[model samples]
Target: MSNDILRLNIPPEEPNLDPNTVCKTYPELSQEQYSLCFEHPDVTASAIQGIQVAIHECQHQLKEYRWNCSSLEKKNKNPHASPLLERGYKETAFAYAISAAGVTHQVAKACSLGKLKSCGCDMSLHGKIRQKWEWGGCSHNVEFGEDFSKKFLDSKERKARDIHGRINIHNNRAGRLAVIKNVNRQCKCHGMSGSCELRTCWKATPEFREVGKRLRRKYEKARKVDILNKATARYRRIRKQTRRTELVYYERSPNYCDPNPLVDSPGTSGRLCNKTSDGVDNCETLCCGRGYNTLRVRRTERCDCKFHWCCYVVCQTCHYNEWVTVCK
Candidate 1:
């Protein structure tokens, strides 16, 4: 199995015990990540949640597209299915960024919510903003989250020092920056009669959905980079010139319309497609002009729900026929 901690071969339900046992529990983690877990002690649980959040958001953002982030799907049949992650496609770049962002976001939120003992609400606020409003609310300590994410997520890549490693590092940083850039100022009023007399504001991370949208936009405008080893002078020059927030990738993706087991791409065949809409999910775009098969099927659902005078609710079983289109 790959050493990637984010892979679908998740560790089984962890028994609640102690922080010092993290290394022993998650043996799949790289040596560097294990060491970081050992040092922080309290951040490992949150980091695991971060990965799950990243995967969920990725699936949500790409649900309408052809690729649909299916390579990351967890299946009992294919525990080692991660060829897409092995490539340097723009999709891979997105995965890296979103995953890192997930870690940074989750960790920061954990700190603010008192879930992590090592950290708490960000205390770095200063300057003209403090002059206007009191920083009393819990601000997500994103800076600390970003730093910790870099130390742990980027650890495996640091050991490689190859072109792939550089690309991963760049995209990972872009993910962290996405979280930082989207931090919003949230405030609450303390006046009795809902008056604007006093306001206390604190920095808050944007909803993860918003972060997913931001990263999706970056994926659409991803920069195609020339592949090169870290030792090359051209590689250094490109690294210096590239913008920090831009997503960069070296390899072109193989248009995920057809299943390619080689890359773990479970193509669009047999996928449901909308026949009438002109969106990316429509049959014309999703099926890649192979045409789709329409089947009339009856669906049974609970409808006509009514609330009784007391508290209980009742619903009637309804049957309806609909035309379902599937990619050929």
Candidate 2:
């Protein structure tokens, strides 16, 4: 998290050399570095913005390294779940790398006096390159749960190969001088060069360094805790819950019977009827021998019965005019 600027010796390249030829020799230049050369430096602005961007990107790389290391260590304790942990590391690393590059580009543009321009590379070039590195090439071939240290070492090798090519191109005398002048101007603009007498800006403050360090530590701790807690919670939920297979049976009351069954009998033609020794009279009565009572009793008996397919059942009251049989 140190804000101390590390001075890189970026001497001018040979003036007679071709930029394309030099670029061809080194394929390792990350998108961030290439962008610096192509955008701000190619224009009138100081390339120091690019260097600062590189520093920011380096910090991101360092943070990613720490995160990955922590993940690997955590996974080691759970050897059975190492593959998933490794995948997490790779996915996080790829996303972080891409995001860091983009942020660096944005910060460079914001800090610089000039605007961002296309590096003459195709609009899709950055995306394509990132895909190749992250999905198709070495990054993809790396196995999860294997030797993470060796995988990191291989990554470093690939990065070194890429950087060597880019630096060689920037080594050209004219390009180097241009970059140096641009950087010097940028430094002076920020009052970090010549008679300005300021050693560094607020960006290089100790408070900022401490903040960055504390934030990174907190993020790492939170991430680890979250991973562990989520996994445990999921496992506990799965273990505590049981799977069911039987259909839920609901016992429903029959709709045939009523407390006042004879009140509205169809046999009465919407009127209360009473048959007694006195005479036929319009009166309500509870008689079991009534025609409406017989119908109600029969319906209730039918409703109380239960039938199932693929079973043996012979209806004792099979006196219905129309009957159907089904076999399972």
Candidate 3:
């Protein structure tokens, strides 16, 4: 596709904002806007490369949000889904974002150099398309079905086995400490220097040393058995929980940009509602909106003197209450 066919107005310079940062900041663009921006070279080539990068980043954020929302919905329905699936979703999303970012960078680079070819139709950002395919392939392979569950279970089993081995080591250390204490006590009773006798006695008297070695081995074996038993019990409990607990994988929904209150009321309080009422009077006073309280009154005289009974609704975000009345 020729970049000229779209006849995009090329800006002299790209915006100063970082595309990655902007995408990370606002995670609520719709899928259509995201696709349109990236797929149509004209959309990005028209603006300075930096502006194009920003728009591309916005598209990535949008895709991420939608993926999250979808994943969440799936998890809600099936609580025992495979965790691998969730991991796959995250990996895939990240891969997609990175690929998209790369493509945006490349396109920006091309446009900046004035080497961009005008395409007759919307040209696929080549780098991003390749990334999408790679990530999508990974996502597909991470299948959350029976095979995935088996692998997940196998991993847990291996971890449990490792824990058992560690428990055995701890038990062995405890047993060794006990034997060393006993040996020291015996040496003290024999009037032998602790370290000197412990080192020499074992070497000089092969029979005595062999007996001690056998005893130590027995103690270690018993301790290991006990540790294994305890570990087995713990593992059983963990396995039971793992088998019963559902692993849900839900895609997070993209957050929609909060509609500008001035342009279109979000059917609720404005962003100003988030402001602290430190200087405002009656900051603690409740507002009519959801969870939104008015600033605390600075003085009794400052309190509204109107004598109408009003309903108080809490602002979902701020938990402040404001007064509202339905016209009779």
Candidate 4:
């Protein structure tokens, strides 16, 4: 399990780039990376990319949920009562998952795209055991990604022994593992006369949507785990049984229907809900028994496209009426 081939060649900072400014401008960069800012100056771009991608993926995944993962965008002016800091909530699980996935995907992508000076296309698998396909293409370096993500994101929990800390670390690892597990392998066939003889293959990380989908599934089946004393062997047994891909929690989540300014929950008031469906997004459930307001609106769209002449196409504009339901 040696990761000797996954090292990063972080270079000294450019004369014009200030490490302090980078940290101040992008608050999402982990403290671990900030500490090593002088050595790895180029991490600024990667950090920003990771945070943006993570937030986007989280919102996309939770679009149908009551909370909709909106807490991730909060400035956390008062960090003491941050909504996303909850330990046992499904939102917290998603936050950790996407954060890890973002960092892993971005780092590997940056390496492949030559955007970062620290690394390049994964060479770790280039000279390994013989296989049917040759590893000649630019493969996403999941090993380097996982190693760097753990070092940066899990550094805060290195000496943490509490249950919450362990839970956070576990969820973070789950996020990174999800990305690595879902890597899609693509191959190019090479032979004479279209006959299959040899293949050039490479591994690529799936879209963040895939990562979010897997994490959401994990959220649905999340387990309530017991936090036992380190002195007891039961603790070891439970830790061993917890799978890396599973989301773990210790307590029930708070009802997000009530507006809790303390936790930054804005409640579901005025939030749009589906009027016809019987799912969680249905107005009956999403409105939280507060009743819903139905409104009719004119929707305008272009339809009946027809190609005219050689270069242009014409479409007709149509107006239709539809109803939108919102929580009262």
The whole-model lDDT of each prediction reads 0.76, 0.24, 0.26, 0.67
Clashing residue pairs for model 1: none
Listed in order, each prediction's TM-score against the native is 0.81, 0.21, 0.15, 0.78
List model 1 lDDT by residue over 4-95, tens digit each: 33322323343232444444554367778777777675676567557656876898899888988757746322211267877889988998
**Pairs of residues clashing in candidate 4:** none
Assess candidate 4 and give its TM-score to the true structure. Answer: 0.78
Tens-place lDDT per residue, model 4, 1-328, is 1111111222223323345544444444445666755565554446444655676567777777787766655442212135456455667766777787877887777677765667788876764434566777888777777777777677765545566667778888899989988898787888998575878888898987788888888888888876554223243455688898888776667678977765567789878899898778898888888999988878686555432111123457899888888899
Q: List where candidate 3 sits over 4 angstroms from the true fold.
A: 1-31, 34-40, 43-88, 115-328
lDDT of 1 at 258: 90
In model 4, state the lDDT of residue 227: 51
Q: How well does candidate 2 match the true structure, expressed as C-alpha RMSD? A: 36.2
Error of 2 at 142 (Å): 34
How far does residue 270 in candidate 2 sit from its true spot (Å)?
99
Q: Report RMSD for candidate 1.
A: 7.5
lDDT of 1 at 199: 78
Top candidate (TM-score): 1
Q: Which ten contiguous residues of candidate 3 have the minimum total lDDT?
A: 305-314
Superposed model 4: Cα runs more than 4 Å off = 1-21, 28-31, 74-81, 127-132, 191-197, 227-237, 297-322
Evaluate candidate 4 by giving its C-alpha RMSD to the native, one decimal.
9.4
lDDT at position 138, candidate 4: 87
